[model samples]
Target: MFDLRMWFRALQIIPRLSKDEWDRLDLVSRWLIATRAAVFVMTIVSAGIGGILAARDGHFSGLNFLACLIGLVFAHATNNLVNDLTDHLQGVDEGNYFRAQYGPQPLEHGLMSVRDVLRYTAITGAIALAAGVWLVAATGTAALGLMLAGVVFVLFYTWPLKHIGLGEPTVLLVWGPLMVGGTYLCTAGQWSWDAALIGTAYALGPTAVLFGKHTDKLPADRAKGIFTLPVLLGEPLARRCVTVMLVLQLLAVVTLVWRGALGWPLLVVLAALPLLRDTAAVFARPRPETCPPGFPKHIWPTYLVAYAFRYNRRFGLLFLLGLLIDLALR
Candidate 1:
């Protein structure tokens, strides 16, 4: 029987499951949990921003935009699968490491085999690659270049990039200029610096989330030789960095509005200011040594990342909403 409830639950949060619980899940539920689909909204918001900008410019293609959206989501899914595979191979997620603590590390948890993960990666990556090929055929070499860049990042992000402190910066570039700007080019039939600028602002949200996650796991990563940005920078500096990035996200939008690249309607992103303030306050303090009183127990091990994810989702949605309003006014 199909378990719609588990499907929704998996999409909402990375549900922790025992092997028996995992065995009962439907395929889609398992995939959703495995890939961390809750975060896929970030990609959707990026693509939506790009498509809306294209429509605002009077150059939108519904078909191309649809393809771009699908392609980006699948590519993200592929990246997640590869991230797990790489970390498993590296022994990074072993010994109840931070990653395996928060969610089911299908491999580390003994729920899935190496072969199982590779098969998932192959199918997901193939779909993403197929979409990219179709897009390149439709949009030409520029699109091809963007597609290749994405592939490179996907292949190497978890290994040297995440391990060497380059991971946070990579997320900024991929989510911002690459994903959002590339989506615009494919759908609008041209490049736009303005769209890229907006993307950079939006990209800060995800970057902050990654920063927070890294910060939360800094001790474990340091012990395990992961050397993520947080490990390299230390917790205090990394926490401060996340706060700054969140503030910069707001400023970037203001700059775009000031330059008239975007209209005043885009100021609607200001609605997320309260979230910014809340996230900033959390980042202002060090992560608690243990799950604080009243905090959700299942999400205990992930403190800063949870707050960052909440703020990012709010900011991303509001940014998209602002774009929609800007389009309506135009």
Candidate 2:
């Protein structure tokens, strides 16, 4: 009853499920769905980018790299679990809000209790903390500081950050400097501003996804008193903001390459420009009132977010691949 297929599906998208269906799922599938594992790929890519860079610089520690990767993924899983719990407690996801419509919000959907989610959060968070403690013991005070910063973001990101307009920007920072650069620091045993800067380009992808999601549910968030960036910007401006961020991602890569910070092989990411264009085109207009032809009906209400997620995966993988290629040639 491992349900390999559900595990795979849960990692690709938030699979909506009835309470009966949820009860039938294996523990792994339940964990994947509950943690919203689909987005963990972003963290993987960031960690890979950091590891590859460390290897390129002749500072890679396989053990440290592996620990960092596990730690970051668990941290992300913990954050997702906490976000759902916090929103539910705040009444932000009531009445079949946008969140419950797209995925099984364990609590919102009556699939789990408050106690169940807290249990998940505590276990997941403890694993992440163990990894961080090991990293700090091995790497010194720098790692400790970075880990603390990550904890702050993980603990409060849903409440004050998303409620205000800081959530999207916080994602960029957490994914970029905090995750990528911190991974590099742990593996390389040194800080590299260059690594952090390079990470910002990739960070933009996840940030765009958050922006798109907020935009997709702008009305609902507004009504719930969640002033996410999109809610404050208004739909049209919010959509444009996502488009701008997507373009900036490409520009960041190009700028790094032009500055000779990266080799020519990194230019391969430029191939993602067409994807950027496609995502921009989607954001240029309003979300359709209904699922368009050929669009997957299950994902209807997630128009902008779906497109942004697609683009982010493509662009992030390309960036990682390009980095690997660059490292090989050097």
Best prediction by lDDT: 2
**Tens digit of lDDT per residue, candidate 1, span 1-330?**
789998888778999999999998888888888899989999999999999999999999999999999999999999999999988898788888988999999999988899999999899899999989999999989899899999999999998998889999999999999988999999999999888988988999999999999999889988988888899999999999999998888888898899998888888889889888888898999889999999899997999999999999988888888889889989
State the displacement of the C-alpha of residue 49, model 2, in Å, after optimal TM-score superposition: 0.9
lDDT of 2 by residue, 197-299 (tens): 8888889989999999999999899888989999998999999989988888888888899997777788888888888888888889888877899999888
Q: Candidate 1, 258: how far from true, in Å?
A: 1.5
Off by over 4 Å in 2: none
Q: What is each predicted model's overall lDDT from 0 to 1?
A: 0.91, 0.92
RMSD for each of the candidates: 0.9, 0.9
